[model samples]
Target: MFNVSDGVPAGGEPVAVTFAAVFVALFVAHQVGDHWIQTQHQASHKGDAGWSGRWACVKHVLTYCATAMVSLAGLAAVTGWCPDGVPAVVGMAVSGVSHFVIDRRWPLRWLADRLGKCPDWLERGGGLYALDQSAHIGFLFIAALVMAS
Candidate 1:
């Protein structure tokens, strides 16, 4: 899956494939993460009242946008789309692992600690949030390879 030549157009720029992969992966990540938070953890609205809750949601969305931008920048660097010749496998591995560690595990733990709760839906196996997160990471890794190639 990491093979660049597999998906890249012969002698053409590889930006489109890479961009698509990133977008898809990020969407998957959000779906899985949001589902986990909603079903399992009970969406913790940080503020009181409808307006406040909406504001909080907006803030959360902004945070996610920032994360996506940073991930893309890092991915571009690791893929050597700038420097060139960097090992695609290494780039994929790094991005995947970092996302798993930082986004899922760490944030879940932190939110649980701060909010005084863990995802109850996760215990029920309603939609396989764990698998979703894993798949999201895997997709990002594959996307990185496709882009790099």
Candidate 2:
């Protein structure tokens, strides 16, 4: 039988570095993908007016930065450099799931309807992008913790 525990030592610098690098790479990739999507959306929309486009751009940039920070914190905890593991994992997972759901334009559309508002393209796009970025960060954090352990 191939035991997962056998692959890792109790704790080590190698695991820490690997975990950090992987998490960071995943975050950066998400940001890049988000930016690409936004650019495409802009091109397709062409001459749409109002603050919606600008808001979407700003929201994505800010969300990406926040996600990166959260991922880093989770990575730090997983490396044993920080004293918390479960909380970090939980936080990352929550953030990740929220991101995924939001990006897919799920419950948000329903909520907006309840408030008597239609779902705009910007709202849908921004939610989907944010959710995806969050999911990536969460998955990377979980992977790092498991591998480090």
Candidate 3:
């Protein structure tokens, strides 16, 4: 877990500013890793079956999680304060697994198809991408909370 200490008087409760900073850091990490760091092959092949797709997704998520960890480390170095616990690890595990599942797109696609008469947007690949990213952002928030807690 990433520890984000805000130089607050140790032994006392943390300040809101610390959490806010961590949240911003994690969010930035998400954007950087998910968009900038990810390669075309990783983006397009994450949902493939067998080892190829699974490996791609794993690599992507590792980079994504590393981004978040580095961001938190940066914040800690600069602020000299951070949350103290395993929250970040737990959060990352949850987020990573969630990301892997969502990126697969099959489950969501199945649901959309089952619900028949779905909106055109929901049926498009772009919509799935949007949904996948939204889920990631949501998990990022959770990760931040884990760090802040």
Highest-lDDT candidate? 3
Tens-digit lDDT track of model 2 for 9-112: 34444556655664564456456545653456543332233466445544554555465555565655664444235644554454445543444343545555
C-alpha displacement of 112 in model 2, angstroms?
0.7
Which tens-of-lDDT digit does each residue in 47-133 have in candidate 1? Answer: 224565555544544444445545555655665334133544454445444443433334444544576544665446542356446
Clashing pairs for model 1 are 40-121
TM-score of each: 0.36, 0.34, 0.81
The reply for model 3, stretches above 4 Å from the true place, is: 1-15, 111-119, 123-125
Cα lDDT tens digits for candidate 3, 64-128: 88887898889888877655656766767877788888777787677667867355777564776
Clashing residue pairs in candidate 3 are 3-82, 4-81, 4-82, 4-83, 5-81, 5-82, 6-81
User: Which scores greater on TM-score, model 2 or model 3?
Assistant: 3
Q: What is the C-alpha lDDT of each candidate?
A: 0.48, 0.49, 0.76
Q: Could you give the candidate ranking by lDDT, starting with the highest?
A: 3, 2, 1
